[model samples]
Target: MRQLLAPALLVAGLLLSGCAGFQPLYAQPGVTRDLGAIEVTAPAGRTGYLMRQHLDDAFAKNHSVAPRYTMDLALAEARYPRGVRIDNVATRYEYVLTVTYVLKDLPSGAVARRGRVRVELTYDSADQPYASISAQQDAQDRATDEAARRIELELAAWLGTTAKVAAK
Candidate 1:
């Protein structure tokens, strides 16, 4: 029985450590985007579907393959983006997306990623009282576009950090 207990402990340790070595090609082990492809989901009564969509788009753009569980990505949704802003009045919205994530060997066993990225597009038509509605909207669109890029860049940084850790 004593010998059996020693072997059992060793096996358990190895199994647990295996998670550390199971690094994904993109992100960390449990911190992966999606296995093959990813799925997206948002909270009840929230409209951050775009958050998941952005991730999907990003993943597809990077890998040229659909995420494994794209339909189920809602389970992994993190942040949300407010809609297109047209004026300085600032139509305010919030996106809260968070999922429990485990990285290869992250501290606290969680990712600061919080799965929450803020996409705020500010249009200051108020600053230019002479600005036309069309101009404001156009500027806002550009802002939104920039915001999307910002989010993608942020996600890339997050993934990059994870990869850097893995190389160590």
Candidate 2:
């Protein structure tokens, strides 16, 4: 029984291994290397600073290597009063951040990818000056974090696909 079970298991394993060519997107070779080689350029401001920081961390970029791609970013922001009090003052506010990015291949000077990512967050508007500012700042931080995450995902997927195509 043991000898038969060993042979059956070996056969099943071999068949399964040969049956599919499925591979995870991130598992592809050169994806991480390409991501780390991207250079990020964002506008100057608090929101832009936040976005750049988040993206750098997400990419785990290595500065020592020469960049293969340059990413240019355009950012737009808006704020609106959501819940209004009876006195016509905003009790809650919604902050919106929209970011458009263009990735250029440095060597070829051609566009590799174009994409946009948006994030929205809400915060309470406190009567106290410092408290209100703090709330708004918190919202901005959260929104940038989310936008950076989305951009990272899109770029990674694109890089993986590009690598696969090049490989073939």
Q: What is the C-alpha RMSD of each candidate to the true structure, in Å?
A: 16.6, 5.0
Which digits, one per residue and each the tens of the lDDT, describe model 2 over residues 1-168? 998999999999999999698788779998888888889999999989999999988888999999999999999999999899999999999999999999999989799899999888899999999999999999999999999999999999988888889999
Please list the residue runs of candidate 1 whose C-alpha ends up more than 4 Å from where it truly belongs after superposition. Answer: 1-64, 68-112, 115-131
**Model 1 Cα lDDT, one tens digit per residue, 59-118:** 453366543332222223222334436653443233222332222222233323433333
| Residue 35 error, candidate 2, Å | 0.8
Backbone clash count, each prediction separately: 17, 0
TM-scores for all candidates: the values are: 0.34, 0.86
For candidate 2, the clash count comes to: 0
